[model samples]
Target chain A: MTGPVLTVRDRGGQRVATLSLGGLARRAGIVGAALVVDLAVLSSAPGTPWWPGIVVLTLALVAAEVPDSQAPLLTLAVAAGWWLAAVPWPAPSPGRVLLVALALLVLHATTAVAAIGPPGRVAEARVVRAAAGRAALVGTGTTGIGALALAADGRVVVPGAVGVALLAVAGLAWAATRPTRQ
Target chain B: MSGWHPTHAHLRAVVAGFGLLVAGLVLGRVDAIVLATPLLLVALAGAQSRPSVVPVLEGPQGALAVHEGEDVVWSATISGLPAGGSVAALHPGQRWLEVEPETGQVVAADDGLATTSIGLRPTRWGWRTLGAPAVTGYDAWAAWRWVADRPQPLRLTVLPSTEQPDTTAPAPHPYGLVGQERAVRLGEGTELAKVRPFEPGDRLRRIHWPTSARTGTLHVTATHADEDAHVVLLLDAVNDVGSSGGLVGERSSMDLAVRAAAVLAEHFLRRGDRVGLRVFGDWRVSFLPSSSGRHQLRRLLNVLSVVEPGTARGEDALAARQGLGAGTLAILLSPLVEPASTQQVAMLTSAGIEVIVVDTLPAELVTGDRGRSPEEQLAWRLRMLQRRLERDRMASLGIPVVTWTGPHSIDKVLRDLARRSATPRLVRR
Candidate 1:
């Protein structure tokens, strides 16, 4: 008998992803739902153009069918679409902005869940619930930040200080999540 | 265990958050930053809350041995998970080791340890490898996962269920040793043999008082000696006919043969008879010398477990007959598909080895079409008829053939052989 040895590698600090045909179908459903939310967020925003929403929806739908390795690109594209649509608007309300952001987060989270584990395996209830809980907390924080910015009338401008602070925070986030070589 | 690492989801969140934050600040669009804060904060929280210690997986343990149709629970535990706890999934290697609900999921405990139980059922008798279960541990947010390093492989040995045969038979021949079977020689034993006039060397305890009183002379009671028998189980593993649906479905010829051999071995061994096993087939031929005790029974079953059907040449029959011991009752378990086995039975019987053949061929093989064409069915029928003739030929040589039907399968044949053993017979040199 040999001593215990771990054979699986911890690359990307992610669960070994499985892409079963059933999981792919489930992911497609999730993407479709996210698109409907995107459309709703875009249609509800004042003076927001419909073309960006259509483009985001189309890209997300197509991305849903792509292999998991390339599927993340679609998530980025969809987020970009929402950002572009909101950018041209004359200062949309914080509530509408927060809604669109939450929707995008949901899309990304669902894709992540769907992409992980072996194919044909459904995500465990606890895993899904825990992820949802995390996403919700993030959504709440985003809402709170949006509320603060709205309260200040989007005019709390401290250019140099904010940039330095943002860079520091981003650096910390990157360091925290980065895989530590054993 | 490897240290924590950010998953693709975490990275994606970080990128989306940072891009929006930088873009919003540069373009002077407060809405973009507002949209980005949530993603950023979530990533930050996940990153900051990286589990302090990697979870160690404990086991895939419990009930390593089980009966057929019984369930064995294989479990593993993960400890040292963060507050959000972890989710562990089990992937048992064998397809027959069916997992309950078919979803291998278990949530971690509040103490940061999670145990997952998977149910496994063995369908057949043998040593089976239940390959190592791959355990993947996901953190609270499912953002990062720590997989257990190499898990140990597990093996399960399934022992055949020993069904006791109801009917009993006298041993054809007994070795002159103390045991359960009564021998022809008179000695001090429980079974009364005779009452005779006491000789001067007779002990006082041997005197039969009533006989002494009636005859006015001392008489001694004599009893038959108890001795053991040598039982040789000759298993013909040359060919298997019909499909085996494991323990539940229709038994193949090999299944029947093995199970019957096991039952016979257990029965004789329990009665203090020295039992041996000899398997002849296309594969490896295994032979065990006659021995008595629980250990020998275990050894016999282990040998029988690995028996598989092999291509039988005429030489195998002669080799099998040669393996039998003198004055031993040789029980041949076979489907009798090959003519070689029939010839072996005839040779053993003619050599005065007291052979009995238990027919293990499933009746369906001869009757059921089983999707065979008319011409194929006709050929099968013809082959079965020839097999019948061969069986009859063995009977003519004084080898009784019986079909295995659980208990009482060999009782009548054994009884007949015992009766015939009383008469003197010539042993071929």
Candidate 2:
């Protein structure tokens, strides 16, 4: 038997780096979604500084490495909040809101798909494509909700008590449906 | 019980969506609600589609035994996952086993059942125990995950690869009544010996009409008897010199010895000859009695697979074994690095058995510096000189030693032995 150093050296000599094709595609999806969201932020808040966008992009890259972490979701929320607070006035047009909502939808879906396995895992192509389809479905429904909210804003108002009760009920339902940990 | 559990994606969606919705309601910002809408829907979809039944994970599916260098696909079957769910299977890395995807991770999705597989190619021969594969199930949106319990670990037996030794030389001593070799004594056979006077029990076809006409008396042809030979392979496992680089890479002395022994055993057994094996230097000096057939070949290969280099203490025990029969051709495979291995050669040759010594040392080790210090280099050179002197001594003692070079390495030695088998020699017993 030889020493561990030589064994490790020989093994290193024999190893060849392998890149999973599926992993590359998933990473691309993450970067693409981040770029779309960043573009929407830029269009929504034209006066905002550029550094925040760069920081969000860096976080997105980190999320690409570890999609299971909170970096992706945190970056998405930061981007959406910056746009909401940076822009002055009654708000950006409905078209801008539609674009931002669609990008956020893609970011969430892609990050979720990437989290299904480890960084090196090669996910099936059909599954990723199916996830994209599901994201598009959610995007369509979200666009409809945005249109409805915009149309009914000045015409309707709910009592403060009813809104609080609805929030409490939704919170209770969500807490009850939380998965039990083994 | 449901094995499904919420994943981090689900938690992130809920926290982010709910936080955004509450903030939008408090500030009356329509954009926050728009932003939270998709995440809320995704979280709701994942919660609604949570798997109700646990997936059934089965044992590995693949060949449990394979020859070295052959590719094997090890897979696990999982059922009862929800539609559009995905499963990821992972088999941890093992020594001498090359796993495709390198990480041993594979992910696939199907209706309710799926099989995930990883490719394994063993680089060396011996028993390899594979760690139990890890399987995880993910729902359609990956909001929920169910990790199945690990299945039983796979135990694979990698048999030594047979390096075909291109030696058609007949065994020096044919001992049995039925085989490919022509025996010394006259008997019912095909090869002509001579025309002789008619003997009692001579068949009518044995009559030589030309000889009978010339001699004016009945004469019959005689032929050599067809018989089989007994071949005993004596393996030297006292020391495994040099470094092994697996099947396709550099080979050490022990690797050469085992592969050569397996090759010779298969060659002899395939020709309908009785072949046996005696592994020296093992704890008990493993021995397999002479036998013929496919089963014997398998048994011999199995024995060769598990041979570990042993100390000198087992030599005496090896000497005491009684199965080395007379007229048996014993082929001793060793690097002759240790005195004990050379002593084995002396013992076999002294027993009046036909013996051939195959040098199993790698050629490069004979001259390479091997990154040794100056003092160690000198010692290595001296050892090589001693090995050379030992080889010369064995040759002078009427024992033939040949270097192993894969196929055809022993053809000349066997031919020489066959030619000399007729000469009478002294036997101690």
Candidate 3:
């Protein structure tokens, strides 16, 4: 968004005037992830109005450029909301859910990478690769979750109880990960 | 840095995951629950991988002393980062320092340690302080972040870049006993002066056989003494006119003055001449006494590197008090923009010290650029006229002025001075 510049400001407000090939590549990666997210949402809902997807894509662009801002979170929320509203609710397939989930995961991971440093930072290849590996792990887990949900669609004795148990597990994980203050 | 704090990305993941899960349960939508699964897993993994120990950051690494236009690396390393944790460093830009990657930002994963570096090339000489590198650590998932304490900025003394001027011109007034220049005084030396009648205390080997036989008397050969010249470089640092664009770009008045002084000092020192330096308009009134050898050259350059213009403008009397020897060749390097500098030249000439003025004002500044307004242009024209008048005055006083044009620039002027020195003339006391 700032265009390909020889210099840019870092998070510490210092003017980083060194141009880097690795930095440019990282910026491209961020934009690419956002584009993929937009495409996946659009493909998931065939007949839905494209305006909502376009709006999410715009937010995604903002997020890619300014990862430290609230734009990235807002973009994710808008994207997920669009997918839910556009896709047919009860008849949504496992493969479609997995596809959208994978796309969102990529977008989130890339935005996180960009957020680690200043807008002009050249994110290390190893760091990016590690993020991808983490995303893949999450993607695989999501697919398994979806498969289990499909298998238990009518076979489970108490579906509500099963949902409650899943929620409790999610809550526990969140509590365990919360940062402890000094 | 304090203990790791949750980043916005982590919060985004948690909120999205929890929101989607609650929505799925409320609407009985299996697709929504499935979508929430990935977000939840990412958030949980991020939490698990959160760095516990504060990363230890060290450096900006590299040499603290270098010459102008020399390339050096400025870098910082962060250690103790957890596996998969990353570090981001930003080294800001500063004037006269050219950094590679224009944007001095770098991110590296902790593979035992991460070192962020930028190639630094100084454009000009002086004491320079490089911007301190700011490092921040992030967990593999970028879920947690911590910033290292800012360290002291790197300071370096950039020695003035010396230009090797190809000048074999001998100094007009060589005085001391040991040197390459032929002195006017009669002494024990190799070159023949004349075969005259032998005098008392004359060595037996000095007798000229053919001349002795022809004159019917013992005759002796006399030769000019080989002695060294004392060169005192006087720098005019009253005002540094024009903007310096570093080594490759347009040079400022001070840049030219300092560099020219450096070249002259090196030349004289290499020739076994005692070279000295006096910085006029410096508050400290820095003066290096004339001495010979390569060590003296280093000391002279070190002194030149610290010259700051307009530092002692009020101390005109102190700046003028340069204690030069009788036969010392004082090379005054100045832009000649100020009246005080011209006065100093007149004072040295009056003291019977041989002085040569090297005009160090850049040509572009002398030839007015079109960017200036009419009034500015007029003022500059008037200034030039005044400068020309001063130069004419110095010239009439038998002092030669030459513009610095790199190698052999002052050779012609020095040759003329040497010829003039041979002839007798009235010199002011």
Against the true structure, what is every candidate's RMSD?
6.9, 4.7, 4.4
Q: List, residue by residue over B88-111, the lDDT tens digit for candidate 3.
A: 777766878877655435465546
Fnat (0 to 1) per candidate:
0.39, 0.43, 0.53
DockQ of each model against the real complex? 0.30, 0.39, 0.48
Cα lDDT for residue A71, model 1? 56
Question: What TM-score, to 2 decimals, does candidate 1 have?
Answer: 0.80
Ranking by DockQ: 3, 2, 1
State the lDDT of candidate 1 residue by residue for B53-141, as single tens digits: 77777875432555455677776777777676555565654433555524354454566766767667776666677767767765665
Can you give the lDDT of residue B132 in candidate 2? 74
Ranking by TM-score: 2, 3, 1
Better of 1 and 3 by TM-score: 3
Clashing pairs in 2: none
Off by over 4 Å in 2: A1-17, A46-49, A150-182, B61-63, B104-109, B310-314, B317-322, B427-429
The candidate, 1 or 3, that scores higher on lDDT is 3
lDDT for A115 (candidate 1):
48
Count of clashing pairs, candidate 1: 7
Where model 1 places Cα greater than 4 Å from the true spot, the runs are A1-39, A42-97, A106-133, A150-170, A173-182, B22-31, B52-73, B77-83, B99-103, B109-112, B193-221, B311-314, B370-378, B396-398, B423-429
Per-model C-alpha lDDT, please?
A: 0.70, 0.78, 0.78
Please give each candidate's TM-score: 0.80, 0.90, 0.86
Better of 1 and 3 by DockQ: 3
- How big an interface RMSD has model 2? 2.9
